[model samples]
Target chain A: MTTGSGGRTVPRERERPGLTPEESALVVRIGVFVKMRWLAIAGVLIASLIATQAFHIQFSLVPIYIICAVMTVYNFLFLYQARHLNVEASDSLPETLAVPLRHLLIIPRATSPLLARARATGNVHIIVDLAALTVLLHYTGGIENPFIFYFVFHVILAGILLHYRVAYLVATWAILTVLLLIGLEYYEVIPHVHLEGFAAAGLYQQGSYILSVLLALSTCLYASAYMVTSISGELRKRQREVVALQQKGLTEKTRELEEASEELTTLEEGRQHLLRFLAIASHDLKAPLSAVQSYIQLMLGGFSGELTDKQRQMLERSSIRITEQLELISDLLDISRIEGGQIVKEMEEMSLSQVVGDSVENVRAMATDKSIKLGTRMPASLPKLKASGVRLKQAITNLLVNAIKFTPENGEVLLRITEQSGDIYTEVLDTGVGIGAEDLPKIFDDFYRGSDREKAGSGLGLSIVKRVVEAHGGKIWAESPNPEDKKGRGSKFTFLLPKNLVIAGKKQGRKARLKSQET
Target chain B: MAYKILLVDDDPDIRDVVTMLLESKGYETVTACDGIECLAALRAEEPDLMIIDLLMPKMDGFAVLKELEDGRWSKYRNIPILILSSVREEASRRRYELETALEFNVDDYVEKPINPEVLLERVERLVNKNKKA
Candidate 1:
């Protein structure tokens, strides 16, 4: 009972069934043939007794009784054979346990009835059919007899059980045998046994009559044989299809399994590449910038040669500008990394107050420098959210920074937290430069700086916020000059997140995986 | 007496700037362009303090820590180490923890684009601590 990879329980392999559908089909054919034989035996006995006693038909009773006894014995022999086989797969040994040797030795030397492992041969029963038909034909009427149709019945059964050519040949032989019997009776070489109560001896003796009758009988036999052969052919084709379906099922499952394992290997390589790229970007991109900034700081701090006020002012300007550019580059990297699937939500039962509190406080100093009132409006007790604190903090901080950047001095920037039915809506409303109608749609797009507002940013901040909100099964939008907003020059950025999260992860990705598995 | 501090960096501009920055504060300074040169200089004449950059050619800052793990610090002057690099402080700390199994740690961590006052204060405090010990 070893566990499979990924902790899946391994299914134990079971032994194949004693009889597959085809084999069971063969058993059914044999059982049906035996049943028909029983019907024939009863029919022959009743018909012979009625013909001999009531109708006084001119057939010998002793020969008919002997044939019946032979058929009965054959039926008993086949029935005895059926007793030994355990076709239901009941007697097979269990995989977990062993059968004792003494049990095998104690069994009688009789063959197991249902133990018929060999593929069923339908042609094996052909002999019994032919013998019975020949005996009935000989006893009741040889020529000028309706009992002659028994030959056609036997030939049709042959067509169903045997190959087309063999069945056709059997039908042809039966027709020729009838013609020979009729010719002999017509020429006075053998006796004609006509059906009792129907005196048709004159018809059998007429050359023209026998010729037409034989011709029509031959055609009928051929057509019946062809019909049975075609039906049998259709059945065999369907059986072959069943086998092919099983094979196709296995192939499809194998292909799906191959694809899944291949995906994991690819994921492993992707992780390694991502880590290496991050390391290189950290050292190569930031290293030189840091070095230049360090040098500029030293000069400004009087570690280098003494600088005049003008020189100091220019150097400090360069330092601040460089710091801002470095910040933009870092934000660009964050945006790219987050898009490349670095946003993993570590779910915790944290409040909306907690999610938004620290970020507003962090941006307070910048807001105060402009004399802007930065405030958060929330319910007395807000609902908790299941999300990653770090990513959520980053998103809130970006929005606040944008609000502070756009808002003029003394402009009020409000962070409104409200529950809209089931959704938790967080809006950052700023009163400053309102975005134009044309620029509203493109505001959240990456690297899109509104042609109206002059504030420079990587322009990825709002897009990242949108992505984070959507990843949490929520959405974000921005509305400038909103009707209910107090500030005329207002740009309100609102994002709604469900307070009750439906599992914190990529729902789309997992759904795609399950959909693939189903196929 | 001026305390001697070893400044190791791959960037020559940074090495010179840090060297002069320490020297201007009355500490004697020697600069090595990379970790290889840094180790060689350490073997030649030990310093009171070492300021190592995390990323360097031939041998990195982590490699220096691994090399010094073999009782080499006991043979020389007790050199309090400080890591100053462009790598995030948390990333560097995690690497050092993994490499030295937290048994050893840098005396101070100062990220790049450092404030001159903070750098000098951290350096002087480490040097003073080493002297007292």
Candidate 2:
């Protein structure tokens, strides 16, 4: 022991708070056994002294002295082992003690062969050792021995540390020892004392019975305490697990909320940008419209006579150019609205042929003006696809308009609808200015037009078509089929849609028979 | 005698097209490439009507309109001003409603690529309207 700055003397064993619970508990139990057995050693010494005075039992004092000497030596040996055991047990404990306890118990069984043998023997070998020790003690003194009840203490200790079967074995050994003493007294195997006075009457019989009852009662108490402690320890472990699971769930929910907030901020920024562009575009458009209005005012006022036919014709062309600019601005605004995720799709089953024919009719005047031959090839039995009719028409009309715009006079633009494997494949093939291979991939991106076709477009038509196709769970791609043959190398745009529309409340079978017939 | 007209715009191609159309119609037309030249031509020879592009370098169409309003010359003052641009309708409506303290007035607005028929019809109507007013 050494005194620390705290002024309290610290034992070498207690200096390290690192003991495993099982190792520490075993050391505590062994210490208690040593203390309890001291009283038994004293009782044996007193009994020998009483025998020498009352009966004048004269024999070689060597056996008596030898028994006392052996008891003294065993007590000192136990004390020495207890101190070392305390130090070893304390050196292993820490804040995280459970793993160390398991390691301490399990490692000794593997590293030390003797300890492994002892553990493998389980409780059966312990009971045999206790039986041998009790039989040796009985030979030293018959039933007249006062220290015989100490065997009960051994039984209770064995019951707490070892299995219940070992406790039962030890109890059987104690009962057998009493029976053997009774048998030896009847046979006159040593001097047997018979008590006669009231003080001595019933003393041997009552003492034996009381000691047996006490042993059984203490065993039961120890077992109940062990059971309660184990159950409470298990409940605490389960509670820690539940808390960890709840914390993980809360962390996941917090991450999802953070992602949603980031997306909302991005959308707000996009809205502000669009508003700024709209302001600038509105201001720039006014200049040209004002010019046309001013010129008409002067011509009509007749400040300089009536205009000739040539002057009238010149003014008509200027008005046409302004109208085209207004149309381009309106289309740009529509595309912005659709991309902002404000547009909702209303999908229905409709005939592909009719939609194509109607789109051609809408743009027939532009085709005639450009002298582009616009025609469609529809299979007699065409597949009806689930789609938003308005969006589908818009997409097709954009493709047709581009084909007519880029194709030279008398070039052919063909629209074909083909059915294959529960899908409708629509292809728009045109004899026009084919897109370069490099520009093919970026054609479907917003505001992306081929450099070759830069002057002719607002660059939004193909992007809108791609958006509509993707919304319907369809795919669209473009290809230049005849790159080597420049005259026949016009671009082909094709898209695929599933024949059956699987949406809410709609049956799986053909839902629009009347619409297909109209085509 | 055909009236002389001055056409001013920033785009060379648009200026060429308008010049061709106006000359083909037998009107004697003088062209200025931008607002600065349009203002210079206005001082040099006052035309019947001034057609100006809204967006340009050095000076813009609105600035030119402001200059016309500030000038005291009766030939340039009270001349009908038309804004030809590619801006949207909402802003065009707003520009028409804008009132300066000096009482500057713009006749009307038109968008591009200048529908020839509508351009002639609107110009003829505004000229007739100014005469009646």
**DockQ (Cα-based) per candidate?**
0.49, 0.05
Q: What share of the true interface contacts does candidate 2 keep?
A: 0.08
Tens digits of lDDT, candidate 2, A1-519:
000111122233433355433334344444555554566556556755665666654333455566556656766765665555433423222213323433543422322322222222223323433443454344444444444555555455545443344455556655666566655654667544542221243444565654664455445434533553354336435645776777789999999999999999988788768766755665456445645534543453343369888876665555445545555665676576455543343455665666777888978998888788888876665555566666788888988887777777888788887768767787888888777888889989877878865455678888888887777778999987533335666888898876554233432224346556787
Off by over 4 Å in 2: A1-205, A208-212, A243-321, A346-351, A381-384, A436-455, A481-489, A500-519, B1-133
Candidate 1: DockQ? 0.49
* Collision count for each candidate, in order: 6, 56
CAPRI tier for the interface of model 1:
medium
Error of 2 at A256 (Å): 4.5
- Model 1 agreement with the true structure over A1-519: per-residue lDDT tens digits: 000111111232212366544445445544555556777778888877887778776566676678778887877765544433344454433211112312332322212333222112233345555665565555566555555666666556666544466568667777867776676777868766666654554776777877777777788888888887788768756876897898799999999999999998899689668866876886788878888999999989988789999999999989988887777777676666565565542445555566688888879899999999998876654555677566677789889998899888988889887767667788888887878999999988887888943566667778878777776778888888854566467788888888566233313222445555675
Q: Tell me the docking grade of candidate 2.
A: incorrect
Question: TM-score, each model?
Answer: 0.66, 0.41
**Span of 10 residues, lowest total lDDT, candidate 2 chain A:** A1-10
Candidate 1 predicts chain B with a TM-score of 0.91
Tens-digit lDDT track for model 2 on B1-133? 6656678888765676566556656666778877889988887867666677776778877677767755365567655666666653334443434534443356777666555566566766655565576
